[model samples]
Target chain A: MFRTISNPWISLASRLILAAVFIYASIDKIAHPDLFAEVVHNYRILPIATENLFAMALPWIELGTGVLLLLGLLTRSAALLSAFMLIVFIAAIGAGLWRGIDITCGCFTVSSEGRQLGWLTLLEDVALLLPSFQLLLTAHPGISLDRRYLPASPLSAEPR
Target chain B: MKDWVAAHRGKATIAGAVLIVCVFGSIGLLRNAVAEHPLAWVAKPPVLVKYDRAVRPSPDALQTVTLEDAAGMAFDAGALFVDARTAEEYAAGHIQGAVNLPTNHYDDELPAVAARLEGMTLIVYCDGGACEASLQVARRLLKSGYAPVVVFTGGWPEWQGAGYPTEAGGTPSP
Candidate 1:
């Protein structure tokens, strides 16, 4: 549904939720860098050196995008980035499942002890994708900093 | 209806769709290109260290080792058999030659056990399939540079079933 948002509050709430998810996920991974690296390794994706780099950098990217989304600054850009990340995650999980490699998804945690990539992980990613897509499709909410710093209409336009 | 057509007709939905396709398609292509390289991020196995160094024999290591073949290998004359179960279980019964290594405290006391069984084949075992202490103990032995670590994967269950010589209580006589 591409219909424009008539209610800005709904849009703002959704943006917050999306941002919170990204920020929360990033913090957990940051806390356990080594374990996260192992999880990334379990995916069997990426060169050895690159896996370490990704394990170090990807969480920050997620955190940055999330903060932007929460602030509603460049909302569309943040949503797009989040969507791209989620899509990549889903694809990786799907590939792991297809190959029958039992490993942790590492989206949430880096530990391989109890985690397993399966249908449920894919579903969670898809759920995150929906809210991100919604933010992308709707206009920036009026309550956001985007509205404050860069109003949709020209600054000279008569105040509503 | 007429007003709607007039407003929407020039929006060029097809061009928009094509632009979306091109962007996503290019991204997909780029991803594929990176993935195709053997050195791509996803191509390598994760690095990890093994806790044990017994060097698990590869499937192709010997091709096959039948009971007769196993028997043919020189048994270490002075090697001691170490049972890694609890004392109570050890008291109930155990392999005739096995001394209690009791893996529950295996980590802390392995050195002492090893010293007693110095220059001996430390065959380690636990209850059975569900037991991991045997493997843990075996790993410890290997780490300590104990030679020729043999793990009876089937452990006590197999030993008892095979009707091998067994004994009860404190350290059976050699």
Candidate 2:
């Protein structure tokens, strides 16, 4: 399974799906940063001083990474970033559940209407996170903008 | 592992962080530079709220009411009690004179409450201290011109726990 995922075609498919999910998740947060910030506050994880900064800045980071990943520009770095974020999200969700903080998941929206954190949300993040982590570890150089524009560095060159 | 770091992780991590900062930070700063106020990331809540006449009252604006206080105010026509739990939760049971204005659905419910609730001391509450719906709803109400509004931090559970006045179903008592 691990070797199969590292195959270029499989990697490309996984990349596209993961990029789409991130891009989709980012739009609501970017559009409603204030609400998103409020949702972050509800989690009671970050201190009050940092909530606004994280909410305002994170969507853009997600958006940038998603776009780059979609274009296969800076593929490995984007994969690493997205994987790191997923891990953080997993931790946040787990913390909220452990502490029994009943708040909106804020995974997809700024609204607390119906999206509360639970075991299912945790499972979903883990499922999604695996591909991102796999992409980073495998680091496949496929049909990518990074491949097209920037060729191999001397470090990546094969020794005879 | 060491070889991979020398090849990949070393430059990539720095590049990613720098890229996010330079791009997003500039956009957020630019938006704040032109808008009515700095956007959330740059705007300190205290600074923004320092001298502004409150649109809604904070919990600190007045003492949080106890079951006794709420019971006494329940009969007053001018005392506005707001339940900040969900409609379903409110429907299940709430303080007798309180109306639902859940944080989740505040935008939908605000106009009606705002128009009719002027001159009333709005007392917002939810499912007790662990619930933030009340706090969020209270802030929105303040922003929407609900003055003298204060939170009852001990919300429904506290009121119910004390066997204070409560009624079930969606409608508020007249």
Candidate 3:
């Protein structure tokens, strides 16, 4: 079970999938901080003062995490952060659903006309958690920048 | 714990990711600083309530009123309080005498209430703290030719908290 789970191919697939998700999610948000800030405000979870700062900072975090994951540098930590972010997203969406507040998800796009917050969004976040956990648990350094920097070990000594 | 950390190469990996995050975060902040309109760090609800008995704000401008303004408007003869909350929320509890014109259903609902809104000042509000429905509805009202539309930023929660008049159970028919 451990060998199958730790397969280099599985690690690579998980890393690539998460990288695409995060990068695609970050673009529009990075372009329009104002719209993103409004979306963040609608959540009503964070304090008013922190909303703008959070809006400004979050997309960059996503972009950086995505780029790092794509390169497979700091793969385990990037996956760890991805897992953390997914949990936060699930919690925020859960809170919004509980409040029955009519709001856009602001997951992919910050536009007012974007996807409405719903149970499906909660499911999507939970689904993304699978790959994040996979990478976190077994990040293979082979075929990644980590191959050179990370100390060679059983994870890196792939039988090619 | 130490072995677990070693197996995952946690120390260096965590450090690298943190460094990347910090660098990118600083870049984002700097970019926002130089942008055309930097977002407000702290939200301060407008003090339109203070305008009452003082100089009325320009008719053309969208005014954000405080709870006091909404309460005062509740009794004012020409002023009409409009609730932008959902019908369910409106039915649950709302400011006394406020008409429901929920922002979500603005298009479908506006026509039903248009005749009643003619020649009246509209004071719009929602659930309060961080709720945007009031502002949205107020904008729609202004566009629909309702002049002197004021947003009660401190909305139902503030009004109810202040021991102001309230109504519940059944939303009045349009």
Candidate 4:
């Protein structure tokens, strides 16, 4: 069971899935930074001073992570970041729910009236964390740029 | 020594993630700086309120209202709520006591409703967040001789989200 769970194919699949999710999530946000800023503010989690900075930077980070995972370059690193982001998302959604903040999830869409922030949104983030953890744990760069470019890297050095 | 490797097993990966964040974050900031309209460093609430000077007959003639002010005025007998959303939306829900005055139907409805609006403060609103129907209606009201017209920029979403007074599926309460 452990070997199957840690299989190279499984790791590759996880990386690709997370990559698509991140890339799709980043597009609207990058195009509409001002609206995205408003969405981030609606969460009311971050300090007001930091909201715009966070809104501007986060989508790009997701885009970068997505591209890296898509290419399977720095697979472990991208996976780690993906997991970290999911944790933050889960927490933010949880906080929003706790405070009864009736807001759109601002997950895939930064639109004002998109998906409402709720337990289902929290669950979706939590489920994405599974694939992120799989990629992080497996670190199996199957047919990947990481395998070709970082041959001597510690993660790639493990016996197949 | 072996324990240290275990402790810092993914240190390089962590560093790589940090580097990716810094690199991409810098790119985002740079792109934002050079963009035509740079995003504000501090995000304000999603209220894009601009009281058009050209449309205003007088400086104090047109005004904007926050949710708190609108809420306070809701109870005032002299203040009347006018919802500028479509009639269907108005039927779905609206601020309690607000009259349905759909922007599209303004010409047909205004003549009938204008006389009833005399000697009262008009608090106009729509669906909010970039929906300018309220502004359009408010401007028309100003032209029609309604004084002290206040546009609730936050509008219905903000009011509904805040759990303020609202009603549905009826002609607006008197």
Query: What ordering of candidates by DockQ runs from best to worst?
Result: 4, 2, 3, 1
Pairs with steric clashes in candidate 1 = A45-B41, A45-B42, A46-B41, A46-B42, A47-B41, B79-B121
Clashes of 1: 6
Superposition error at B17 for model 1 (Å): 21
What iRMS does model 4 reach? 5.3
User: Candidate 1 or 2, higher TM-score?
Assistant: 2
> Top model by DockQ, which number?
4
Docking class of 1: incorrect
Kindly provide the TM-score obtained by chain B of candidate 3 when compared with the true chain B: 0.65
lDDT of 2 by residue, B1-174 (tens): 435545775475456546665686566546545656345554344311222223543444433566666666767787878998888888999888778887866778877666557888788889886676777787777777667666777788888998877899988876
- Model 3 C-alpha lDDT per residue in residues B90-166, reported as the tens digit of each score: 89988777788876467778987787788888888888887788876786787677777878888888899999878
Error of 1 at B106 (Å): 17
Q: Write the per-residue lDDT of candidate 1 for residues B92-167, one digit (tens) a residue.
A: 9987767777643555556655566777656677776645556646655765777656565567787687676678
The runs of at least 3 residues in candidate 4 whose Cα sits more than 4 Å from the true structure, single-residue gaps closed, are A155-160, B1-8, B44-91, B95-174
Separate clash counts for every candidate: 6, 2, 0, 0
Candidate 2 residue-wise lDDT at A94: 98
TM-score of 1: 0.50
Q: How well docked is model 2, in DockQ terms?
A: 0.41
lDDT of model number 3 = 0.78
Candidates sorted on lDDT, descending: 4, 3, 2, 1
Worst 10 residues of 2 chain A by lDDT: A151-160
